[model samples]
Target: MDTNKVDNKGYLDMELLRFSTAGSVDDGKSTLIGRLLYDSKAIFQDQIEAIEKASAQKGDEHINLALLTDGLRAEREQGITIDVAYRYFSTPKRKFIIADTPGHIQYTRNMVTGASTSNLSIILVDSRNGIIEQTHRHTFIASLLQIPHVVVCINKMDLVDWSQEVFEKIKAEYSAFVSKLNIKDITFIPISALNGDNVVDRSENMPWYKGSTLLYHLETVHIGSDHNHIDCRFPVQYVIRPQSVEFHDYRGYAGRIAGGIFKKDDKIMALPSGFTSSIKSIDTFEGEIEQAFAPMSVTITLEDDIDISRGDMIVRENNVPKIGQDIELMICWLNETPLKLNGKYALMHTSRECRCIIKDVKYKININTLHRNEEDKNIGLNDIGRISVRTTTPLFYDTYRRNRNTGSLIIIDEQTNETVGAGMII
Candidate 1:
């Protein structure tokens, strides 16, 4: 057995997890976040001391863990999270990025923005309150965004005396509700974010619970397959022509690999043009690479001088994406004004950009119960709805369930120049 080779392979198997926290105000979201960071030893001593001093100045009896994530002046003064605060931390097993979003209903757009690219969503629920309408809304949004995993942290367990009965009751209630959702993986944990119980370390208080700590679960969750690895979709962002004396004939197509893997000498086709080409070499700032995968930005040189440019898609020859001008999408309205019926808008889908118009409002979803109301003509702010759109140019993409990077798009209001809605290809 080759021990050195085994060790080398093991080193490359480590995973990265991106998760976002969503909960109503006072759901102990900030405290749970602070606990995760503190217990993981990701926080610096100086930062802790600074928070402690601030806590004392505020006449707090104990250090307020929520203060660790409440960095904005408005949030501190108002005692509410306004904007999304992103935090990064890592352990020996995995790396993580936390998107802590505000809980207010008006900040639904912010939550969408934060969870759009997340692999998991940590929804905080107050143990005392059990489940509320806000919980349903957040979970629905998580399902709507197609987050792969969800961890329901039943916070403030200490306030409920760490009772096993209480935990089970809440878990059952949440489970029954989430059963209606499309979420595949759902786990519940009884935790006290303030006391750091069952967040990073196992809670001795809750002997009835047998699950791993939240940190352990997060670090161990399988996330490598969360990204699309079957369909090879690369949208050309730019044409790199380094017309220098050293490399006079250099012409490479620069873009990020949106899905699957790309290697040297693989056969690929340019969308809209249907031009066949073979990969000559895949180059990066670090030099040539033998292969590339989702999110890796590289310049690919082809064997043939095909006329490929921006707004074009490079995909596997056999695994071509759906190309069409009529798209059916599930859009989350972000603007206060009602969606202009059949109004023209600009659609941005990966590197392929085009103008689109809402063909018709299919139905509006009731977030609390996930019910579709076709009678409601009002698609106001914070409303999620299904609609059909007609684009000026055809877009080459896969369904959101197949490829998030290529399946999601944003609609801009031409008059206001503001992003009005975000859509997931159905």
Candidate 2:
């Protein structure tokens, strides 16, 4: 294979999509991923031979595709996934990143970590079991994380004789339940992962289904609108100063664009300081860029020499983020220890770090039932609830639904320095 030829043929320009899979035990989540990789020709021959040998050693009659994803020894012995396994593959049209998360209820925190940054989510449902508690749990998490796209792959269609009735029944049930959810985009497909039906290629057995296959949908889905381009948010991460004799006075603010488009000569405002400046130029390693947008990393030079440093945000004067010390948010406790009320923890936002105290626990949410427990203030591991926080410094943020990068934060235990909770500004 010619590496240079592949690189020059628009390989670096291809758009990347991150997706995650979730389901209950024996629901075929791992098998579906293996089939996707196999049918897409993403796996090598030696990997296939190794899985075949492992399957034979276990005395299985057929090769187990689930072994491709369940890489840990404990997972193989218990026949269940325990951690979040990430796999990468690419087709001619686009590149893909798959996060295979554990399905057990106790590992709910693992699923949250995997799906937090995903553009889409796949919730595998066993056709024999239909909609269950775990299905609701995963769906609710997908919604909480604001994953834009959802594909409910109803697996094991072969076991039900490829019946169209079973497919529609599950679809209808899911639709009725999800009507109350905040999910905007959802697609349902019936597939037998073990048989390679409707995963990558079109299924011959399911003639009644007229929709595109899973891979086709993933490649064609419109994700350009998933980002927040209306709000201008750029949190300064580093201040670059040159000590060279040729360009000794050059100073640039370096950070990833959190939102909106920033163009050369555009007027911008610095947060906390309230100083205004015009963009002198945008600097990138390749060359001076004319403009930059959300999620792009670039260094910007301002016309003024006003004092600026890390943790300060640059934004549009008219459309500024909310600046305050008190914030209300939905908190997901991640550690094994219970969250302490009125406890102080190290809080980190985009390019900013400070200390925050849990001022109040408003309510705890039951993910399975989508109910809020107003009376219970105690929050434990894998538990999600609404809480009010008071930070040491004013935080500039937008609602998580509007801007994920600016609205999300992590709380660390001050003594252990371990991350104990994650929050989304409500």
TM-score of each: 0.92, 0.96
Model 2 is weakest, by summed lDDT over 10 consecutive residues, at 1-10
TM-score of 2: 0.96
Q: Residue-pair clashes per candidate, as listed? A: 0, 0
User: How well does model 1 score by local distance difference test?
Assistant: 0.87
Every candidate's lDDT: 0.87, 0.90
| Model 2, span 210-292: residue lDDT tens | 99788899988999988888899999999999899987999999999999999999999999899999999999999999999
- The best candidate by lDDT is 2
Deviation in Å, model 2, residue 113 alpha carbon: 0.4
**Candidate 2 Cα errors over 4 Å, as ranges:** 1-10
